[model samples]
Target: MKTIASCVQEIIISSPFLEEGLSREIINFSALAKDLNKPISNMLRKPVKNGAIMMALRRYQQPLNLENSNRLKTTFKALGDITVRSNLSDFTFQNSKTLIRSHSQILEKISANSQIFYAFTRGILESNIIISSSEKESITNAFKNETLIGSKDKLSAISIYLPNGNSEIAGLYYQIFKRLAWENITLYEVVSTTNEFTIVVEDDLVDKAFSVIKRLKD
Candidate 1:
């Protein structure tokens, strides 16, 4: 089995679509191998560690089809290779009667409960804060520490994971959001960590948002 790097090199070489130029030459493994004076055989001998090479091939084979694949590339290029998993914990308020307010007001109230808030930048809204006991502490703590360590307003946050700090994939979030915004769905807060992204929305819009995301995902 050939390694991923080598496979990528070969794929680039095999693709006539890459064009004839320095940029094309740079991505081509044979050229790169010669330029760096490395053994082409050595590079091709190793199987791809992850699925990056295969991903690249998929991209060249079909441009517009791999909506998710393009997302993976854009994100991987920006954040590096990362593992994304949906967080299972739910958010719920102690009282179901908490008044809905503007983003600033919501942040202020949530901030009073804790210091560290869950934040995310992009992605779809799945549901309203379902405040189960398991997530209360984190929620409460975020409220207490309302002051997020950023130049912008850091009231409440949506915690997100970034496998390797890749921001290019952030565009995928933008893509999903464009349609939502068109439909008048407003996003309140965003926070990202290392692995996943989360978006907070108004309680009233939770169900609608979830449906949109479900439709897009499906």
Candidate 2:
């Protein structure tokens, strides 16, 4: 059986945006009580009042601490060299030795003319190759399979170089994603390496995204 305190704590921890409300002690008690009453009724055999839920919330609240806040801000500041690249294209290839050969061939041709970013997961080899509109035909022809090309001028990439000692920190990516999600920014794709993280978004949102990241430093 779940107590009101445990239930309220679970809700706050699971929701990144709601965590702030908990910190500020401004969460809606009525709404929370209503949400939990049905499920908790099965366990406790009765409905609980908003006042009881509110009391449990206050009693079990986990306030944000200065150490964690300082660590996060430091990590953000250490993220040096935030760069945005435009006029990008994306290609997703099925994972195979043939795909690797095709990728190499395409890379040779576009090495001098464009910037290439690629990643390999379990079954897909995804590439976001930034090239000029005039060079698109030459690049596309190099691949044997159908390649998915994105809007020529609409896509943009934002790359962040993480500071040393912060790349391995837990919840680092969550902090970045949470800010973007809160602003309703749609991420086209995400690429990451040991010390760098990159996200592709519409060109229009580049500035807004950059601003959101910079605010983490403050």
Candidate 3:
């Protein structure tokens, strides 16, 4: 049989925002108990009273605080280095495979001269590429069969390098993203490798984003 405490922990882990409400004492226990009874009953194979559910929620709140603190420590430690690049342009291409074959030389030229940011979606319906603004002319000439959806210039790229061992830590990216989201900065796109995370945004927001991320290191 599943214990009340275990069931409560499962619920909090699954719905992380619930812990926030519980800890703030903003959640109405009666409604929460009623809503959770069905799932908890399903898990335990027996019905539970509302009072038992409320008690379980209260018991698990302290543990959730400790867990969040440990997660923040791990995430901060994983962030090794941060950098920003500006004056970039983003291009979206349709029918990318055809474009690749038709303009191999031009593509190579752009690749050699610029920091290329490229992603191809499954089924090859669309491909998005970004490069330095100086390579715009070469990229334009390269498209024979591919449709140029649009291009955006004056963009900035923020590169976050993670520690070697902790690069793969869970929630590391989320912590960075959450900080950006909190500041209401719109992201153009995000690209990542095993040890590096990059977010592209408009050039104007670069300083604000950099400051926000710098605080994470403090």
Candidate 4:
């Protein structure tokens, strides 16, 4: 059976901003319950008193970071390396049947150089290619016939090597990203793998972004 606490937890966890507010004790419990009253009542299949939902809100604990804090700290301490690449180009192209062919052509033209930084992230309706600014001309030549959605220049990337198997640990990413968010850093793109997390930001903000990420273990 779904208890009031379960329903409250479900609602809060779905919105990170609300969860953060609750954690910081900045949310007014009664007001929150007022807003959540109908939803919680619908969830419980019965009318729930707003006061009871408020009580549940007060009782709800953040299951994400409290237990995982120490483990996340350890993982941060063991972060392998912080790699920063500059003068990057970000190319976003609308998805198309011919998009993959264009990508293949670009790879064939440039993958020979092991020194350059290159990354490609595909989304449902679009895809992004981040490469050294020097490759801008090559990308243009390859995607000339395709739909160029948007692009940005003077970008930089920060790739943090995570400890092995960090994927299994909940809140690892939240802890890492929360700090950057606090600093008001606008993330252009975020790419990650099993053991690595990379963020793309404007060149001017790279220093502050790097500092925020570096201090996560501190």
Candidate 5:
């Protein structure tokens, strides 16, 4: 008979988290065994151990670090006070520091959602502009070509918004993303504008990823 521990191990290795590599930093079987007060060796011996292993693999697949720790606090501070109900947008393919312009409608829609994560000073707009729903549709449709570079298993995307007179700021943002990549946090998508940059990640990693960017502003 297959030992229960062994079975559990088999299941974990089979899961997508291990296969996809989106969050390898957060998941570790041996660490989990220690946490649960079980010996790593014994946990490896159970039948259907594969399932447990996979569960453990996914448990921390979302990157959680000092950045997210602060983001949660800041997000709460900036947008948390609003009464609108909004789900955190799944910007799994967005990068930061690029100017983002929305069509009339998207801005309105975004304004309604309370989970809005960032604060930008719109210097020129006489009034505080919000993302109306129509504007959201126009912007998403406006950007036709999406460019992503890196390995398929680990990819990063950066949105480019090269406008007159803003090259220096763009370079700074690029450098920041590059440094994070050096730390092995692969980026998925980058959305940009002459003055804005939006970074995206797997949904599970959003909070932790947000934390990472928050540090740069501090």
Candidate 6:
């Protein structure tokens, strides 16, 4: 059965900013309890006192924050190389039966050039391709018949080398994305592997983006 504390915890986890604010002790507990009163009551199928919600929040935030903070600290300290590749292009295509075939063509064309940067991600509705600007023509030719949803030139990508076992770290991605969003940076495209995190942004803003991520290590 749902209780006040469980409901409050559910609310907190769903809203990441709330978790962060509460973690930092910057959020107003009484005010938060009042705001959450209706939701917790609805979840428990009954009325919940504001003071009871506040007490649950107080009970949960510290240990939760401490655990996450310790993991984050270790992860950042173990962060590997941060490589930035400039002058890239991003292409978004509406997915089609031919999409995978077209992507293969581009890969075959550029496979010989180890210096060229390329990354492709196929989503359910769309397929995104990011490549070195000089290599954009190859993709354009390869995907000529595909439906192009959007494309951006003069983009740059930051490929962050993550430490081992990052996939097991809770809230790891949230913290990285939170820092970038806090800086008001626009992420044009993002792709990742098990231990490699990549973010593509406009060419001009790359330096600022790099600075922001680099500081995460310090």
- Models 1 onward score TM values of 0.31, 0.80, 0.65, 0.74, 0.28, 0.78
Best by TM-score: 2
Clashes of each: 47, 0, 0, 0, 69, 0
Badly placed stretches (over 4 Å) of model 4 are 1-67
Better of 2 and 6 by lDDT: 6
User: Which pairs of residues have clashing backbones in candidate 3?
Assistant: none
lDDT of 6 by residue, 1-218 (tens): 78887788888888867877887789899999999999888888888899999899888853357776788899998899999998888899999999999988988888999989999888889988888889777888988999999999999899899999899989788888987886778898889999999999998789999998998888
- Per-residue CA lDDT of model 2 for 10-67, tens digit only, reads 7678777777655666767677667666765555667777677767766765666677
lDDT of 3 by residue, 1-218 (tens): 57877988888876646765676788988889888888988888888888998788766754435665676676676577788888888887776456666456665565654356443322357667767777677677776457877779999888888667555455667667766876788899888777777888999899999898778876
Candidate 2 lDDT at 32 equals 65
* Model 3 stretches with alpha carbons more than 4 Å out: 1-72, 111-124
RMSD each, Å: 15.9, 3.3, 5.0, 3.6, 15.8, 3.2
Candidates by lDDT, descending order: 4, 6, 3, 2, 1, 5
- Ten residues in a row with the worst lDDT in model 1? 148-157
Candidate with better TM-score, 4 vs 5:
4
Q: What stretches of model 1 exceed 4 Å from their correct place?
A: 1-170
**Per-residue lDDT of candidate 1, residues 61-164 (tens digit):** 32344766676555534432222223223333222122232223545655656532333221232223423233455454553433222222212223234455
lDDT of each: 0.43, 0.69, 0.74, 0.89, 0.40, 0.87
RMSD of 4: 3.6
Best by lDDT: 4
